[model samples]
Target: MRTGIRQTDVLIVGAGPTGLALGIDLARHGVDALVVERGGTLTPGSRGKGLQPRTMEVYEDLGVLDEILAAGGPYPVGMIWQDGRQAGEHRMFDPAEDGEEGSRFTGPWMVPQWRNQEILRARLEQLGGSLSFGREVTGIEQDADGVTAHFATGEPVRARYAVAADGGRSAVRRALNIGMTGETVDPDPLLVADVRIAGLERTWWHVFPPAGEGAGFLALCPLAGTEDFQLVAQFPDGTDLEPLLTLDGVRKVVADRTHLAAEAVTEVGWSSNFRPRAALADRFREGRVFLAGDAAHVHSPAGGQGLNTSVQDAYNLGWKLGAVLGGRAPESLLDTYEEERRPNAAAMLGLSTAIHRDEARRGAKTRQLGLNYRESSLSEETRPAPGEIRAGDRMPDLTVDGVRLFDRLRGPEWAVVELEDGVFLVRPDGYVGWAGDSTEGLEGYRARVGA
Candidate 1:
């Protein structure tokens, strides 16, 4: 089944949302890329269904944030339940109180993972790039010249570099001998199902905590405003997944809180059993191969930060790779991938590893505002000063010239933000350099980034 080795500027593995995000960024930079997916089918139903403001900002910078928002449902309206009653809700992520100027993603947002993938896919297609489906990359060989990816079938692809945006259990990462060190769990398998119901308002996560010891818990998360929901429940030690198909079976679990009768159920879209894990690859890049998204880190789904972090990983790596390939930036710029993102990934890993039951976040800080990448190549020149958001501080939404990013930010380039005083400079990689009332300090800033 092997064909002659093929060549490309960049080769991406996995066709999930993370891979698509990377694809969109690479295409935006005018870097022709070939993205390959091992799976032949578009993952049915929305998985990992929440997008935070920072994520929205990334999408905005990508230029497709509006289309993405249009396809998404109402957001920041999630609630947690203890037993059968509501316990807490996500109501505020106020930017103004935090001293943020103007931003677009002012609150939390929701969008089915599939729709996000669809948007990125469409963008990739319009940008003259297509995904190679059903081609499983069995192996890879990289040298100074370029990288060659070997597939199980069809022709192999060769590129200047290969990016592994694969999922948590990335085969590419394993093959690279990358060490994923963290808490690996083998808890009793849990049931994860995506289904549609007729009588339910799909707005918040409905939790039915175990009333007694040894009893399993239940969590029903709404997706796309449809009665459809992704349900997760702990199993009694070792339980099989087939029984969930019966209407009575679903009622036995869902009826714990929702008054809806069993007759209201319609379809079961997808179901599986999994034990969540908190893992991080020892390194983000090696030789001509680099890892992005879940390929680099994975955490418990408790925080909904998994998808958000993966998208950010792609954002961090995309421009560095493009710059190196396009000959616009020096090779040393590539090292920042580990510097800026690894710390954040480590923090997320810590959050997931130390999760609190009945809550979606690890700590108050781990929420949307916890991400800060100060000590990066993008910030090495302009150190953090008082009265200004520092290099390692969260890149606050700057309101100047009417461009606002209150959500996930699309990036990989510098954002020339004009401040009232010194004209703050934003690195394309998403970091704030010098922020002053005047541009009187160009010599030091220019020397650091070699601009």
Candidate 2:
């Protein structure tokens, strides 16, 4: 590794799913990207596991569907729960056919965040790319010509553009003096544990909400690599967890909530605390340094939209950045990244806050699949009324012909989809820029996209 200086067309900080997804997208266009990560290596934590249909489409296009499917778990049987008395149950989404256009992923995928990184790392190596770990970025200084980044250990790297995919504690954003607004919706602490729950052989995490002011809510979700369940419980608003966070205390909650026998108790592997955060940065880009994923936005793990949306954010921006780096489009095209992705991030933040307030969603959310962006520059040509705007709101998971689209088209690039009645242009980031009843010679469309 060169410590004095390094250079690449697009310098990406953080090799998490978002940064890695962006790297693959750039490589597909043959654009050179240098990825820097502050973490020593891939951290072994099964953080987020839900991959939405739109995100699957982006990943399939990037050529890593098989890996995801292999690593992820079985499709859940939706969710089953009621307010207090176990409200019956219902299927989350129709797995039979995905009706959405411009998207390839049908439902949600349950894979650990680390496993997602492992697959992306392998794919990066396959594409003749490399990553530098333990390269914590300390500051980012950008000029009219390019941007220079300084790390704690190395000299600096100059690039045409830089993206900050760093986690919630992003230094790039702070160094650039970016303002972020939003805070923890629940100031109280919740115990989050990832372990294989014994004696459970089926899908669907058994859940039990807290009883009253002194009780705690139980969140039992599935995980990858075993029959274990990810359990989360809310402690009293200001109660001290120092006494009741051990294996015995957590097991008592699980046993009481699910009514499982004592023999069903299993070993606790990993345990931690989580404070659901619902926040978004004031802006996604400042001069040459841009933000993505948690760096740009942070929200509760509700609706499983955080990771999926983050991946889509990178996918949407990657090609646009590559196009500019390769000189295919004017540098002004990069401005569209913030223009398009910021509003969508705000929407996710709002929805996630709602979910955190009340955790009841079982699986993939159909509403999340249908977010609309009529005000974006990417959709000026194919303007449609709110009634006419469907694909722009949500990418349907339906398959048109004999081929399955969702499994086939999730990669790190844009997918221009042609629906039965209209045509919708889907960016790799999983947002619909242009959608209308007809995509006839696309004269106006080409002029709008400037392609």
Candidate 3:
């Protein structure tokens, strides 16, 4: 490695929600990290528009939930249309019960992917983290000590640990020779575009089923906090629709699929086409390089789990990386990142695939609140008989001493919750690390985890 090369404690590739959220977590931990993006500006699109309840809690911990809620709104009811007339209403998400106790955020919040990234970037910058845009990682080299990321332009970055949050087509993951193995979730390619329409109402998510056999479905969802309506249309397998990303092409699709004319689409902001697929990397880590978000796992957008899962991936790795990099914990702690996240990502991938195939519904599973790490090596259940909430479960938000549980678990610290009967220790990422009738091994666990 060349002397005077740019250096940081952690090098995060990509500036999407995953990388930005991880950057925020590390920055708050006083870790020196740098985020590098291949593009000069943030990617533009309403790609992943739904934030699950678990992710809302993550945002709150990162100190950006207020901004996220202020910038987005609840998903509107789906309005079915037939013969150019109102047919009926369809609920896109499962209705939330009044005052759900386990979580404060009951339902998924609707926020465009671009807006979400912007908010995360803002929060990261506020924490004094640095992001280098237009810096593409062409290759990466790692050894026993650290990793070096070579760029297409500008100086290469040397960091104690490198994270590949650079999307599914991660250059660093590829350079490390990591293999992703999975099947295509769907054969039919889907076109998604953000556009401003003149005639569509923003009140409901407009849904148009297939007109006839071999036809496809079309959905125009009003993106909250913006004038753009996210247009999603399915096409036959092997359909060549790359040329349809143009403004005219989008307008033609909208006019042909619905009652609206081509002129109804006033402006097309961003568009892309993709076949829904679910894939997980063979391993989440290779030497000093760790893969996070889409770099490690890819999922269909059906259950809206891709972005949220990816963000949580970063959350899971952030604290571990911070601990090791800050010299507070042993390097062995980093291994748990792959241990805990890979299985969760695999499960979420199955859920997304199931939803895409219509074999499952977007209900409790899609909300991501039930996901746990009870099977993880770090989880310890010392109680004789645990209640509904056990070790490795997500710590439910409750008022203890008039302070919300989430309030105590907000920062990068282990929280010990004292309930009426037993005691529970919550990890920084909000999972119960230990549970027992008393604090029998709490000190040992705390010393081991560097809490």
Candidate 4:
């Protein structure tokens, strides 16, 4: 390493779920990567608390599923309150059927965003990955060779590739002059805080609907595996939000909306205010630098899609980067990162916006199990008669030769499985990349993928 410059195969900007998860994935593949964060520590608060099933699967592959399961629990039933009395029970998400075969997790899990990042960072470090805090990326420049990222306080970092996992107002994306197109899902700003309430039960998500005109709805959902409850209140449009971020202001809002008194709030840990919005970057790539997570797309929190989509963005990019940097795949293989992820991100943005507006419910669609890359240029389906599982679809967990399928697909390698005498090439990300009755096209596909 030079005096003021560091070198790595991949430079990941931002240490949120996206960047940390990408670091873990790349590390498991034996790739030398560095994750840099602008902040001094992992983010706090119960932001983006829900982990969808697809993301749970991704965690399993990244070797952190056990920690995630132990640190979080399932979403509780919603308890509706009226005039300080229990009005009725409301189900936040549509009831899902029993977990289907090959599906281990069918519902969303609730874990505070802070805890989730802790687990990801721990796993990344355990895998020999490197992360440095307080490394603020001021701007980044990329050429045909590599990317050079200049920070505010340290020597610049140079890498063969760079990714912006920064948030919606991504500084890296702006540095590349990428544009975001989006709309506000709601005019009213929402107040979300992590606080401890004296008498609130932890078994149910408490809901307080508006009692009269000019009043807003309030919901206090207990953050699983923690003592604090996440308070969410919708304010009238154009209302000033500066006061609501304080402890007294939160107590006042709780007292006014629900039956709770101002004295019931014991402690306030973190708070934030934001108007719900959904947006996507015009492009996911610029030269050797690419955008993932919030930098690539921003979603309303209604359907818990933001964080999950962001993690999946990292998962989708990780294997491709490993393949290219390791000299296993063609440089052009990197193009598929944007081609496969951008459209999916746009669709998720629409789904999140719809759910925020009550046009869609959190159920089958929000689970994200059915999301795939069937149309990607890398997806090759040469079978004369495709079965229930096709190329580009998520490879379901199954048992073969008394061994688990996902266990076989684990780690950083492509897998080939024979089902009904048909050959299936599973990508490292757990998607079926190619399917055929024989090895007719497997070698050609492998050559292209550097598998």
Tens digits of per-residue lDDT for model 3 on 179-263?
Answer: 9999999999999999999978899999999998888999999999999999999999999999999999998898888999999
CA displacement after TM-score superposition, residue 47 of candidate 3 (Å): 0.5
How many clashes does each candidate structure show, in the order listed? 32, 28, 0, 0
Worst 10 residues of 1 by lDDT: 92-101
Query: What tens digits encode model 4's per-residue C-alpha lDDT throughout 1-451?
Result: 3466788999999999999999999998889999999999998898999999899999998999999999999999999999999999998887666656356888999999999999999999999999999988888887778899999998899999999998998999999999999998999899999999998889999999988988789999999999999999999999998898999999999989988889999889999999999899999999999999999998999989999999989999999999988889999999999999999999999999999988988988788888999999999999888998899999888888899888888888999999984799999999999999998889989987898
lDDT of 2 by residue, 1-451 (tens): 3355787888989898998988888888788888888878975667777777767656777888888888886556535444534555545444524454435455677887878999998898789776889899877888888899988997688888899998788888888888899988887787877765676655665666565667776767777665667777787667666555567867776666655654465766667776788888989989988899989998787657788778878877887887677666677888888987898888778777876676544333433556555566666444355344344454555566776555434554456677665777665455565666677645566545544
Candidate 4 local lDDT, residue 157: 96
- Model 1, which residues run further than 4 Å from truth? 1-4, 75-102, 184-188, 242-252, 255-260, 357-367, 381-385, 401-413, 418-423, 433-451
Model 1, 1-451: lDDT tens per residue? 2246665678889888788888888888889888888879655557677786678777877777878778776543547666445778754232223443334444556787777788888888987876888888788787778777777889878888888987888888888999988775436567777777776667666656676777777777777645578777776656775786455677666665455566666777777666778888899888888887788988777666788888888887887778777877677878888888888888877765656343333334444454666565566333234455654555666544565543324445564455443355666646665555556675566555543
lDDT of 3: 0.92
Q: lDDT (0-100) at residue 220 of candidate 4?
A: 97
Pairs that clash in candidate 4:
none
**Which scores greater on TM-score, model 2 or model 3?**
3
Model 4, 245: alpha-carbon shift in Å?
A: 0.9
- The TM-score, computed over Cα atoms with residue i paired to residue i, of candidate 4 is 0.98
Worst 10 residues of 4 by lDDT: 94-103
